[model samples]
Target chain A: MNSRLIIANIIRWLILLLFQILILRNMSFYNMATPFVYVLFLLLLPFGIPNILLYLIAFGTGLTLDSFYDTLGVHTSACVALAFVRILFISVTVRDGSDEPEPTLGNMGFKWFLLYAVLCIFSHHITLFFLETFRLTEINYTLLRCALSSILTLFVVILIEFVFYNRKVR
Target chain B: MRNLWIFISRYNAFFFFIIFFTAGIILTVRNNIYQRSVTFNSTNQVVGDVYKNLNVLKKYINLGAVNDSLAAENAKLKTEILSIKNIDTTKETVVKDSAGIPQYTYLPARVIKNSITNRNNFITINKGKADGLSAGMPVISPIKGVVGYIQDVSEHLATIRSLLHKETYISVSIKKNNAVGSLIWGEGNFDYRKAQIKDIPNHFKLSLKDTVITSGFSSFPQGVLVGTVSNTGISAGENFKTIEINLFNDFSTLQYVYVIKDKYAQEQKELEAKLTNEQ
Candidate 1:
C-alpha cells in the first residue's frame, strides 16, 4: 500500500507538471487567463499522508512552477494555504465519520465528491490568484482573472480525476 | 519523554506546514532576487524564438487590416512622389539633395501581438536584429502617426513600449507656430496625449484645433504629425499653457508599422555627449 501510494503521488506530480508547463501557460482570453494546474498535486494526495508532508509537497509544487513562470512565489504561498485548508474541507464534507480517513472522493457519494472536489480547487485557485495580484491597483482585472481561472480549473480537475481515478474500488 | 515523542509524531504535519509556508513567503518577498534562477524569461532567446513562431500565427488574423493600411500608405507615397516631380527646383532654394528624402530610414514591420487595455501595455513586432531593429527607435503606424518606441530586441523579434505607458515622454511642438512642448501620456485611454507648452506668452491666446507635431529634438523629424488639440486652457497660477490633444492614431487596430532609424543619430548623440563633458 505504501509503495502504491508513493508511486501514485509521483505520477500525479508528473501529470500536473506537464499540464501546467505545456498546455496552460499560453492559454489566454484578453490577458485575464493563465490556468493554475499545479494545485492538482495537492488536491489529490491520499487522505493518510501526514499534513506536514502535504503542506511541504504543496509548497514545493507551487515554488517549482513559479520558478519556471518567473512569477516569484505567489503560487507557493497560496498552495501551502490551500494544503492547510484541505483537512477542514474534508471534515466538513464528511461530518459523520469519526476515525475514517478524510476521503478525497470514492467513500463519499457522487454528489458529495463533486462538492468536495470543487470547493478545494476553488479555495486554492482563488487564494493563489489573489495573492499573485497583490498590487491593489489592478484589483478589478485581477478579480476577473481569478474568477475565470477558478471556473476553468474546477472543470479541468474533475475531468482529470474522472478519466484517471480507479473506478472499481474506493 | 514518551509524551514528548508522541506529540512530535502526532504534529509532524503541522511542523512541516510551518516550514513550507515560511519558505513560500520568503520566496514571494525576495522574488526579484530569486528571478535570477529563472532560465525561461520572456527575453530569453528560446522564449523569444517561441514568440517569433507565435507571430506567424497572429499574422494570419491581422492580414486584412494590414493589407488595407499598406494600400493606404502606398497611395499617399505615390501622391508625394508626383508632387516632388512637379516641383520646379529653380524657384526653391534647396540646401541638399537628400532634403527631399526623409533623413530617417523606415523598416516595414508587422505587429504580432499588442495590448492596449493594460496600464503598462507593450507591442511585439516581427522585425528585430536581423532587420536592423533595435531598442530606442521610434515605431509608427503606416499612416505616419506615432505609435510607440521599441523597448526590447531579440534576433528576430522586438517589443515596443506603447505610448500608453505612464512614463513615456516625447518632445513635440505645435505644427503651425513650432511652439515646443513635451507630450505626456495619461493613465488609461491612449487615444489622447497631453502637451505641456511651458512659457507660452499669455499674449499668444491658444485656441482649440491647434495642431501638434513631433519636435526635432527626437530622432523623429520636425513635421511628423502627432495630433490636433481637443482643448486648451491656462492652469490656476501658471504663466505657461496646457493643451489636451486628441491623438490621431487608433492603438486598438494597429497592424503595420514603420521603425524609423535616424541616419545622423550616432553623430548627434556623440556631439551632445562631448558638449556635456566640456561644461
Candidate 2:
C-alpha cells in the first residue's frame, strides 16, 4: 500500500476508536439500540489484505473497545469471528471477476455495499449480544436486542460512508 | 520439514484465529460468576481510571436527582435517630447487658459504575481495602433495602455482586410472622422492581403489601427491610409458595450505599466451623 493510504487508514482507525469509546459508548436508545460503528475499521480494510494481519487488527480493535466497555472478552470474540468470515462474505457479494479494492459504497454499488454491511453487522451483533447475555432463558430478549442493535449499527455505518467517502467513486 | 514449514506458513491466519478466540472464551468464562475469577476484569487500574474520569463528568448531570435522594435519606435518618434516643432514655433504668452492644458498623461509599440489564450484573464502588472494605461484607442502599455483598476488592475499588444477579440468594422472612424463605433474582425477572422469594410454606397466611426483611442468618442484620410481597402463587407439584416482592430501593439509579461490617462475624464463623468438625 502507498504511504498516503496507510496514513489515512491509521487516522481512520484512531477516529473510529475514539468516537466509539468517548461518545457512542454512552449512547444507547431505549436501553436496547446500541450502535457499534467501530467495526467499520474491519469492514473497510483494503481488499486482499493479509489474512493474518486482518485477524490481528480485528482482535486489537475489539480488545481496545472491550477495555472501555468493561466487557473483557466479549467484543474480542465477536470481532475475531467477523474478521474470520469476512473473506467469505466478500466472495459471496462481489462478482466473480470484479477485482474490487475495498468494500465501500464508492467502490461497490449501493446494493452490494448494503448487503455486505448488513451481513457483517448482523454476525457481529449476534455473536456479541449472545456472548454478553450468555443465557438461554432470555432468548427472546437477546434476539430483540441483537436485531435492533444490528439495524442501528448498519444505519450509522452507511451514513458514515455516504458522508465521508462520497467523492471517491471507483 | 520444508513441506511442514510451508503448511504452517500458509494457514497461519487460521491458527492465530483459533488461539485468540480460545483465549477470549477462556477469559469470559474465568471472569463469569462460575469461576469467580477476580483478575482480567474492568476493576483493573487502567480501565477503572478511565471510568472514574468519565463518571466525574456524568455525575454533574445527575447532581439534582442525587441531591434530592440524599435529602430524603437524611430526613428518614433523623426520624430513626430520634426514636432511638427516646428508647434509650426509657431503657436507662433497666439492667445493662452484653446483648445490647452494637454488632455492626456502617461504611459509606459511592457507586462509580453499575448495571441492571445484564443477567449477572455488578456494581463498582469507590471504596475498597484501603477504606476498611473487604469481601463478603453486606452492602445496603441509601435506604434500608439490601444492595449486595462485596465480591472482590482492590486497593481503591470494589466490585459488588448486585442483588439483581442470578446467582444471588439471601435468607429473608416476613416481618409479621417471621416466616422464613430465600430471596432470588430468577430468570425472566426483567422488572427492576420485583424479585422472587422461594421456600415460603404454602399454608402461611400471606397478604398483599406484607413486608419482607433479612432473617439475620446470613451477612445482613436481622430485620433489614427487603421489600413487600406483591404477588403470590403455588406452582403445580411444589409444596412451597412463589412470592413476588417489589423492592423498596430502585437499582437503576443507585448512588450512595453503606457497607455493613459485622464485628462478631469471625467468632460466629469459627463456632460454626467447630460444630461442623464435631459432626
Candidate 3:
C-alpha cells in the first residue's frame, strides 16, 4: 500500500532477476550446477507479508526466468512451490512470540538459515529437474543437478543477505 | 460468511501457489505447446544482442587459433591445387559448380556456444542470414573434421544440430575401401559415433584405422573426413555390421567451423521431393 514498500519489493525482485539471468546462468559447472537465486526473493519477503501478493510475485519472477531459459515451466513450478513452502520453513525455524523483528538470513544465523533455505530450494529443484527429465532413466543426472543447484543457491542467498541487510533482527 | 471469506483470503496464497505450480507441470507435460512459447516469449532482440556481443568477444579471443587453422587449411588447399594444376576437365552434376566442382561454398564460422551434456544438444554459430546461410546447411569443423549440420535459422544467427543428437544420421563411408555406412551419434559425448554399414555386405575384412568419409548421399559432399574405425562388430541379433567411430572433432572446444552451402540445394530438394511424391 505504501510507496516505499512497493519500491522496495520492485528493487528486491529486480535484483533477484538479474542475479538469476546474468550470474547464476553462466556458472553452470558440469552442466548440473544450476544455481537458482530467485528463491532469495521469497526468503527475504517481510515476515507477515500477504500470501496472495507473494504468490503473484513468485509466479511472475519464475515465469519470466523460464521464458529466458527457453524452458516452458520448470522455473515457474519450482518458484511457486518454493514460495508456498517458504512460510512453513520460516515458522518452523523461528520461535513464536519471541519479538522476532524479521527472518532474514543474517538475523537467523547463517548455519540455521542455510539449512532451512537448502531444504526449500532442494525440494523445488528436485521437482523441477524431475519434470524436465520426465523419466526415471535420468534419475542420477536429475538428482545431481538438484543437489548441486541447491548448494550454489544456498551460498548465493546467504551472501546476498549478508551484503545488503543489517543483521540485528530475527 | 465473513469468516469463510477471511479463510479463503488467508489461504488464497497457498491455493494460488498450488495452481501455478500445477500449471507449470502441465506446461512441462505439454512440451509441444511449451516449445512453441519459445517463438513468442523469448526476447530475441535482447538475447540475440547479448549472444552477438559474446560471439564477437569469443571471435577476438580465438583469433590466433582461427588464423592458425585457416593457414593450415590454406597450405593443404595449395598442395591440392598444385597436384591438380595441369588437369582441365569439366562435367556437370546435380550439385557441381561451373568448373565441375561442388556448388557448395564453405563459410568459416565460430561457435559462440554449444551444449552437449543435454539430451538434445544444439550448437550456436556466428554466421546467419546475413552470411548467405539458410536452414538445413551442414556445418563441419575444418580442424577437427565433421561436427554437425545446421537445423534452425535466424537473422544473424543459426542453431546447429550437433552430431550428439539422437535423431541425426549422416551419410558416410569407409574412405580406404569405399564401404558405405551411416554415421550417427546415438549415445552420449561427441568423442564417439556409431556408424552402421548396412549397405556393405558381410565378408569384407574391416579393420581398425579404416578412414570414414562423407558418402555424398546427403547434403555433405564426398571425401569430407568423418573418423577412423575404433571397433567393428556384427549386431548381437541382427545381420547388419555396426562400426564404432572415434570422432576426430573435439566438440568440447569447437571454436571454428565451415558452414557448407550447396548452391543447388533448392533445386535438388525440389527434385527429390517430386521423386518421392511420384514413388
Candidate 4:
C-alpha cells in the first residue's frame, strides 16, 4: 500500500519481464527444459495485496510473455489460474499467527517455500503445456514437458532468490 | 439489494477470474493461420520489431552455416540445369501449352519466424502482398521440397500453415506404385521430421524408401518432392494402409523458402466453381 512498496513492485515487474523475454526466452535446455523465472514475481508478491490486483498483474504478465512466445493466450490463462489459486497455497504454507508481509525464502522457511514454489510452477506448466498441445493423444508428452519444465523453473527461481535476496530479512 | 451487493463484492475476485479465463481460452482456440488476432501474436508491430532485431543477431551467428547451405544449393541447381538440357534433347516437352509459357513463378523470401512445437505450427516470412504474394500460394524449400502454403498476407509480412500443423492434409502420391493418399501430421509428432500418409489401399505393393511427391490436385504443383516412406502399417478393421514418411526438408532450421505464384490459379478456381454451381 505504501509508495515505496508500489515502486519496488514496479521495478521488480520490469526486471522480471526483461529477463524473461530477452534472456530466458531462447534458453531451452536440450529442447525440453525451459525456465520460466518470471513466475517468481507472482510468488514474491505481498500477501496483503488485493486479490483483484493480483489477478490483473498475473494477466498482464502472462499476456506480455504470450506476445513474445507467439502463444496467443495459453500463458495468460495459465498465469491467471495460478494467481487465483495462489491464496490457497499461502494459507496452507504460512502459519495462522505469522505476520509475513511478503512470501520470500528469507521470510518463509525454505521447506515451505519449496513446497509452495513446486505447486505453483507445476500447476502453471501443466495447464500451459496441455493447453498449447490441446490433444488427448499427446497427454504423455505434455506431462513430460510439464514435469521437466517445472523442475527447471523451480531451480532457476531458487537460484535467483539465493543470489539476490539471501542477505535480506523480514 | 444490500445483501446482493455484499455477495457481489465478496466474490468479485472469482468473477474477474472467470471473465479473464474465458477470454484467454477464446483467444487461444479461435485463432488460426488465416485470421490471426493482431493483439497478442508475434506478427503485430511491437512483437515483430523485437523478433526482427533478434533475428538480425541470430543471422550473424549462423552466417557460416548459411553460406555452406547456399553453396550446396547452388551446386544442386547447376546439376539440375544440365540434366534438364539433356532431357530437352532426348524427350518430348510435356509441360508446355501451344504458347509455351511457364505455369509457375518463384519469389524468394526469408523466413523471419517459424515454429514446430505447437499443435498448429505456422511460419512467418518477409514477403507479402507488396511482393506479389497471396494466400494459397505454395511455398517450397531451397531444395524444391514442399514446405507449406501461404494462409495470410499483410503489406510486408505473410504467415504460412506448415506441414507440421495438425489440420494440414496434403495430396501426395507414392512414386513407385503411383498410389495417391493424403499426408498429414498427426498429434505427438514433436520431431517435425516425418508425416503420415493415410487412405492408401493395402493391395498396393508399398516398400521401404518409396518416394512421395505432390499430386498437383491442390495448391502445390505436381512432382514436388514430399518425403520418403520410413514405415508402413495397417489400421485395425480398416482396408487402408498407414505410411510414415521422412520429410525432405528440415523444418526446424529452415531459413529461406520460395513462394510459387501460379498465373492460372484464378482462372482454374473460377472454372471449378462454375462447374460445381451448375451441378
For candidate 3 chain A, which ten residues in a row score worst on lDDT? Answer: A94-103
Expressed as tens digits, the lDDT of each residue in A54-133 for candidate 3 is 77777777789888887877778887888877867766666666454456766667787777788788877887777676
- In model 2, residue pairs whose N, Cα or C atoms come closer than 3 Å (at least 3 residues apart or on different chains), thus clashing, are none
Query: What are the per-residue Cα lDDT tens digits for candidate 4 across A40-127?
Result: 9998898888888898889989999888988888899899878866867776556756677688888777888899899888888887
Q: Give stretches of model 1 more than 4 Å off.
A: A1-170, B1-64, B90-102, B187-203
Candidate 3 residues lying further than 4 Å off, grouped into runs, are A1-170, B1-42, B55-67, B88-102, B188-200, B235-237
- Runs of candidate 4 with Cα error greater than 4 angstroms are A1-170, B1-43, B87-94, B97-100, B235-237
TM-score of chain A of each: 0.84, 0.93, 0.85, 0.92
Structural similarity of chain A in candidate 4, as TM-score: 0.92
For model 4 the TM-score comes to: 0.51
* Top candidate by lDDT: 2
Better of 1 and 2 by lDDT: 2
Residues B1-279, model 4: lDDT tens digits: 999999987877778789888877777777633224433443477777777787887778878867888998899889988888778566556676568878888898988898988878999999989999889888999774898889999888899999888767889999887898998886445668988888888788888898999998887888899889998765666788778889998888788899999989999999999999998
lDDT tens string, model 2, A95-153? 65666667778877788888888888898899888888876678999999999999999
CA error at residue B193 for candidate 2, angstroms: 2.0
TM-score of chain B of each: 0.73, 0.79, 0.73, 0.78
After aligning candidate 1 to the native by TM-score, how far in Å is the CA of B238 from where it should be?
Answer: 0.9
